[model samples]
Structures are given as C-alpha cells and as structure tokens.
Target: MPAALADGVVTRIPTSRKVVALTFDGGAGSQGAASILSTLRSQGVPASFFVTGEFATANPALVRQMAAVGPVGNHTWDHPHLTSLSDTAVRTELSRAESAVRAATGRTPRPFFRFPFGEYSTRTLALVHASGYGAVGWTTDSLGWKGTSGGQSVDSVVARVLAGRTPGQVVLMHVGANPDDGTTLDAAALPRVIAGYRAAGYGFTTLDALR
Candidate 1:
C-alpha cells in the first residue's frame, strides 16, 4: 500500500519496476546550470529539477532547459524550510514557485513538491497535500551539500547511489544554489552517476512517474 500523508497525498511508489528518479534542486547559477544540463543532454538522461521561484525568475533559460528535458517541480520561493513557516507562507512559496516555472516553461508541472532541506512538519505536509502537490523526499541522499572530501568525490557519490538505491528511489542532488557549498561537486558527479546507474541496469525517470 502507498504511504498516505496528511490531506490524502501518497508518498510511496505504486509500481515495482527497477527504476529510480534523479532530481536536482535550486538551480540559478550560470556555469553550473549550463554544465549540468549539458551533461544530462549528452547522456540522454532525463531528470527532475525542483527549482525555487526566485531562481527560476533569475535564470529563466535554465528553467526552460530543464523543462525541455524533464519535469520541473516547485521547490518554494527562497528554499525555506517549510516546517518553520505558517500555512500561508507555505502556500505563497509554492504558488510563487509554480507561477515562475509555468511562466518560464509554459508548461504546468505535475503535483510534485520537494521540501527544502527535507524539513517539514505535519502541518507543512498537510498544506502541500491540500494544494494538490505530492511531497517528495529522497530514499538515498548523496550528501553532496556537505562539502567533505568524500562528499565531493564523484566516484564516491555514484557508488553510494548505485549500491544503496533500489527501484523508485529518488536520488537527491543540488544545482549550485549555495555559493559556499559543494554543488559544483554534484555537477561533476552527474555524468558518472548517470553512467553508473545505467550500467547497473537501472533506467531513470522523472518524479511525475513516481506519482
């Protein structure tokens, strides 16, 4: 049975295929955005990008590129931890981000939502569910945001995802939102990650498929 959250949203997968989803979050940088998109395009891999409203507005071209290849989900306006915000604030964040993505891509994304930093309360989940968005959390984390030597290593990240991830897994990564962080490492690791997964007989899917 699928795991149902507040407001009747289901989180678990309904299928049994040996496929997982790759999702990038918070894309607004020029070089980092271009590099990641190009890598995915070159590899013929599709990924979901959970973008903040502000970032989408600032980098509309990047948003269009992401949407052109795969699905673009809402990641809030400023990447705030939705757990700490009121319901009204949560709505604003999601609505603004959805609007920006639609304006940039001219396509409305499916009802998918990834909470920034994976911080969400029951109330936040309820709000998201009521708003018709499925709350997406990862099954395997690359820890690419940590900036540790291990986290910055592409081989290490790919190995972790390939070894631990199973069907319907959502592999979490970032697209250079934090200036002081190691999102560059994520960009570097992407090609290896895709190759590793493909070699392991796993096909990538967007978050909409999971829903």
Candidate 2:
C-alpha cells in the first residue's frame, strides 16, 4: 500500500557515505528565486525544490527553469500546516499543488511532498500518501528561512548549515525571503555554502538521487 511505502515520512536517507541533498522550498517571498537558481546552476549542482501552488502559478518561468535543472515537489497549496486541516483538506491542498506544478513544468512533480512549517501528524501523513506523495522532512535545516532577520545574519545562516551537515543529511533552505524584513540571504549564502561543502569533501545530490 502507499502508506507502507511512505512509512514514517522520510527525514533523511539511510546512507553511510559522504553525500547530502540540498533542497529549497518556494513560497511567499520567492522574489529571490532567480538568484538561488543562478547559484545552483553556476555550481552545476543538483538540488530539489518543494514549491507551493501559488509559487508555481505566480512564477511559471522560474518554475520551468528550476524544473530543467532540478526535480520539483509539492509543498502544498498555500503553505498551510497540514496538521491543522482535515484529511480531506490535506488532500485538496496537495492535489492543487500537483496541478500547478504540472501546469508550469508540463510534468507531474516528483512524488515528494513536504508539510508546510514542518508540521504533520499520523493522519496527515496517511492523507499525504493517499494523495500520492511521499512526505519529505529534513535532517538539517539551513535556517536560511531566518535570512538576515530574526537576529540571524547571512554568516549565521551559513554557519547553521555547516554545523548541522553530516553524511546523508537533507538540508532545508528557502527560495523565499524572511517574513520579518523581507530580507533574502539564501541566494547570497548558497554559493558560499556550496563552496564550503565542496571544500569539506561533501558531494551534493538531489532528493531523487537520495532514494
């Protein structure tokens, strides 16, 4: 059954080797998306993006560009916390995102779904898989969501990412800006982060490559 396949919602892939997946979420403050994409492209690195429906619809051109270079996944309709919604609502959210992603990329997104705000429950998990997506979680959060506000600077964001990184770790970042001052550090910090990882001998891979 799909539930069995989606068991426990993958937080990190089980691997002993020195590999990590770099992933970004696209939602509200996606104006910095192009820069993030540019950094990824310039590095020739593979990554994954979990974008909301509004993000895909509002930025179709950016969506297509990301799809060409990295795999895309459903991040829900409007970045709602699934645990707050009924099972039916959860399904609706995921389906709407799927539809948007498909429209933008002309392909069904990878069957990877991430709960908005990293919030989920058993019922939400079952609903996610029932909607045909494997719920994805993170082992390492870039806290890039912190951006330059929330008392965290660009250097702090990079430090947070470097500190939590480990083999088989899945890092979480955002293509959006901070909700506070609308500061966007992800694009600026990504190139340095990538370079740091390479220096540390950590290889990058996409989520699809994880499984």
Candidate 3:
C-alpha cells in the first residue's frame, strides 16, 4: 500500500482497459440516492460510493442498499477537510466513519477513502495512509452537485462524464442535491449517461480495480 500511496492520490483507475469507475460522494443529504440506485440497477451498471459517518448513521437503510450492490468507501466523519485537522483528528475522522459504516451495515470500508471537497495536503495524505486507507480522487467531476441554479443541468452532467471518457477514468458525482436549488441532476442524468457510455462502446466498472 505504501508503494501505491507513494503517488499520493489516485485520480484514475490504474488500468488501460476501456472501463470507467463511477463513484458517488454522500454527505449533506440523500435526495438523489434512491433514484441513482434504481438507475444503476436497471442499467446493470456498477458504481462505488464514498459516504460520511454522519450519512451512514442517519441513513442506515440506504447504506445497506449501497453495500448490497457495490463497495462503499469512507468519506470521513463530518466530511471535514483533512488538511485542516491535526493528525489525531484526521485519524479520528477516518476511524469514526469506518465504525459508522460497520455499525450501519456490518461491513467494513477499509483501505478506501476520499478527501472532503477533494482537499488534502502532503501531510494529510500521509496521515490518511497511516490510518490504513488509500485516497481515491477522480478523473473528472460531473459537477451535478452544483445544480441548475449553479448553471449545471442534466445535459452538462452527461457531457462532463463523456468528455472525461478514457481507460480507467473515475467519474465523481454526488448523491445529494444542491442545497440552494434542490436539484438532483446526477440522478436525472444517470440513465442518459449510462446509455451514452454504452453507446460509445465503453464498459462500466467500480473502484475495485485499485484494490
């Protein structure tokens, strides 16, 4: 793991195959979760989710459903910026999230984590590794979390995902809606995005490639 962590953070799946890893981050809310799950199941697509401790604790049923389909990674306890916390605090966040996931679904979120707001520093990276987790970033963000109010629509989300298409690409999306506009663009764009990818002759994958 240290040899892999030597690179600091992973933004793309470490492969040259024509497959992309779809990932969702959950923190503030679970507005789009059910729809996202339904779309993935209906399309037979696989995706990973990185959720906070608070989210798992609050939404145990959703966590179970997520764990049933794909791997769930830790996104920290409160989704705090790891770079802003001390070493012990950072560790506590990771451990707390891991515990919350286990408590909710009786499954472990070992060795996989993502920084809140994609924020981290060299020291924070080392701290994450030391806490027994790998930091997974993304090849591109769908930006659907920004919602229509932020000038993002379902079409833009699909476009951003297709624009980042490549071998082992990691697409980042959020399971929550925009706090301001309350739009779940990711869920709305998911079916179309999956169709577009299949039409482009690309396959879907989870972050398990890195494991």
Candidate 4:
C-alpha cells in the first residue's frame, strides 16, 4: 500500500487515476538543490518534497523555490524514526517541522508526512492523523540514497520504476546531501526517470494530488 493509504488512512481524493507522485526527501544542498529544481522545471515535472526542519531553515530560499514549484511536506525536525520516539517527542518533531515549513514558504504544508525510514506505529499514525496530515509511504522506491557509481544508470532505475508501478503509486527519492550509502543514484538517474515515466503515459503529481 502507498504511504497515504497504509493502515487504512484515507484521503479526500478518490483513488482513480493513472497518476503517481514523485517525492524527494531531505537535502537542500546548494548546487544539488538547484540542479534538481532545474531538471524538474525543464521537464515540466512537479514533485513533493519532504524536508527536514533544519534543512528548510538552512536553505529557506531553496524551500521557497521548491514550494513555488510544487507542494512541500514535513519530514520532521531531524529525520528521526518516529516509531522509536515517544508520542510527545513525535508530536514535537512534527510541530517543529511544520513551523519551519510555514515560516519559510509562507503557507502551511498540506496534510502530508513521510516517516524517516518508513517506520511508524499505530500511535504515530494516530498522531499523524490528529495532526491533520496524511501519512505517506512509497510504493516504488528508486533506492537513490545508495550512492553507487553505476547506481545512477538511467536505464536501470527507469526499468525498476516502470516495471512495478501501478496507478496511485508513490515514488521515493532523495535530494539531501548525498548519503554515505551508495544511494545518490536518484540525482544522476532523475532525468531518465522522468523521461521514462512520461514515455509510459504516467502523469506526475504531488502528494497532495495523491491524497
């Protein structure tokens, strides 16, 4: 199940489109952030960004730039695993990130949150619901965090996303400073990923649309 619908969480939109939402987590590194936004704009693609509060504050300009391009969601203060934190801690994380996003973008984020590692509990889910945000997870992950030298092979990443994708799929990638793990494949593979999806007749949307 996509993160939006996991644990039977529901959205206001009816799930009836051959559309998928592409989401990038963390990172607002100067050059990398510019490149990602440039690529998306040039390709006419829109994405959802789940940004950490620290990242948003560090790169307020980039956050505004991204928000101008598409929807931005809270990815928590430091990208901690919400399920491991107590309920009060989890709420604090969500609240702090939400505050940062609102301060940077001048608009409150939509009801969208992605767990740091897709790890959550019933209590976390309920808190997310109570916070009025939909919990989002990915159906197809590009695994771009693993910064393999050959990992960015456009053909392979495209193949993976296209091979397993279904309507309403949520695709996950990253925009943070390259992970020590070989997952930076996302940045290198991004262009091809977008092209392949377009070729496959899949329209891209933000998580707000997914919801």
All models: lDDT? 0.76, 0.83, 0.90, 0.75
Q: Which prediction has the highest lDDT against the true structure?
A: 3
lDDT of 2 by residue, 1-211 (tens): 3332368778776777788888889989786788988888888988899999999999999999989887899999899877888878887888899999999999887578888888888888888777777877888887767755567778987888888778878888888888887888877788888988888999987777544
- Residue 198 of model 2 has an lDDT of 88
Model 3 Cα lDDT, one tens digit per residue, 1-211: 6345346789988777889999999999999999999998888898999999999999999988898778899999998877878899998999999999999889888778999999999898888888788899999999999999999999999999999899999999999999999999999999999988899999988877787
The 10 consecutive residues of candidate 2 with the worst lDDT sum are 1-10
Candidate 3, superposed: residue stretches over 4 Å from native: 2-6
For candidate 1, write residues 1-211 as lDDT tens digits: 1133223333334457878788888744544678889999988888888888898899988899999888898888888777878889899988998899898999765477788878887788778877778777777777665545444566676777777768778788877734564346677788888878888788878766754
Candidates in order, TM-scores: namely 0.87, 0.94, 0.97, 0.86
State the lDDT at 194 in candidate 3. 91
Compare candidates 1 and 2 on lDDT and give the better one. Answer: 2
Q: Distance (Å) between predicted and true CA of 113, model 4? A: 0.8
For candidate 2, the per-residue lDDT at 136 reads: 78
TM-score of decoy 2: 0.94
Candidate 1 at residue 128, lDDT?
Answer: 83
